[model samples]
Target: MDTGRKQNLKEARTLQIWNVIYDIIEVVVSLIAGFTANSSALIGWGLDSTIEVISAGTLGWRLHGEIKGLDERRVERRKMITLYVIAISFALICVFISYDSISKLISKETASWSTVGIVILIISLAVNPILIYYKRKYGHKLDSPALLADAKDTFICLYQTVVVLIGLLLVKWLGWWWADPVAALLIVPYAAKEGWEAFSKAQRIKNNIDRK
Candidate 1:
């Protein structure tokens, strides 16, 4: 490999590693505050964070393969397996979140406004768009589909952050507690879409392998 490509891979690996660490912290904080506040938005954000970890991990593994000169077929197979697991997991998360949000709406339960969630969303807003910018830049430069896909995932996270922020602000500022579950329900279709995309990608990979 040329020095430029090698450097690019190194940078991509570093970025993925940092993504993993950041997601872990977000997962813990979001989940804790979510349950404590009974906020479906925060809980859905936490679940999405978990899926981000998997996406980053898959990209990291692909970068590792690139660096180690691993067999292309073998790496693709591993990638398919990872994506399948993620698709299944995300589908389950979507179902759970949908059920919780619908139940909360039906019962007319009000989630207590969480200052912590507000603070976290603010931080996420500041951080994630910047992450998306770099991920897209490097992903295109490196010709990495996995990194590009992860950039889209980061974009989704940013969108979720904004939605949750609006929901929390409405609850705290305007006494619109129902906004919480409604905002969380917005996450469901996006989650299902992503899950379907992943599943389709996995199937395509399997078909390609079979053809080979």
Candidate 2:
């Protein structure tokens, strides 16, 4: 393999490892924040992180076994499996959040919990964009759609964090109970978009300019 390809794979492997760590951390944080705030969106966010952990693990394992471009039947199967699992997981989370948020909206209850959630939101907002940019850099360098899709998902996470933060602040200050559920509702489109991206990854790769 060329030196450039070698370097690219190495970077992809490292990025996958980082993603694993980040996802684990995210799941933990979101779980705590969700329960504390009684926010279904936050709980659903935790579920998404768990799926990311699976996706990152699969990517890392697949990348580790590859010398360059992967052609083995097992590796290809693993990638496809990972893609399906993540796609299903994203859809599930989106549906759960939508249902939960709508219920909350109808009941008209404000979310409460965690000055710490706001703090977590601030940190995620600060960190995710840079990680996503690097993920995109590695994706372009490596011609890897999984990495790019994961980056896009992280941006959604960032957007959710911002929305949740706004919701929390409004609930705290304006006494707008609806703000919290509204914030959760705002995430639906992004969640579905991420789900579609996960589902489309391999198909998109297959339908390349050369294939078409």
lDDT of each: 0.88, 0.76
Which tens-of-lDDT digit does each residue in 1-212 have in candidate 2?
79878878888888789878877887898789888889765676577667768877888888876755666665666676677787788788788888888998888766786666666677777778888898899888888777787777777777777777888788889988888778877877877876787678655544452353
Clashes of each: 0, 0
List residue ranges in candidate 2 displaced over 4 A. Answer: 68-73, 202-212
Clashing pairs in 1: none
* Model 2 lDDT, residue 172, Cα: 82
Encode model 1's per-residue lDDT on 46-73: one tens digit a residue: 8988998888887788888888878889
RMSD of 1: 1.0
Which 10 consecutive positions of candidate 1 have the poorest summed lDDT?
113-122
lDDT of 2 at 36: 80
List ranges where model 1 is wrong by over 4 Å.
none
Clash pairs for candidate 2:
none
Measured against the true structure, the TM-scores of the candidates, in listed sequence, are 0.97, 0.85
Which ten-residue region of model 2 has the weakest summed lDDT?
A: 203-212
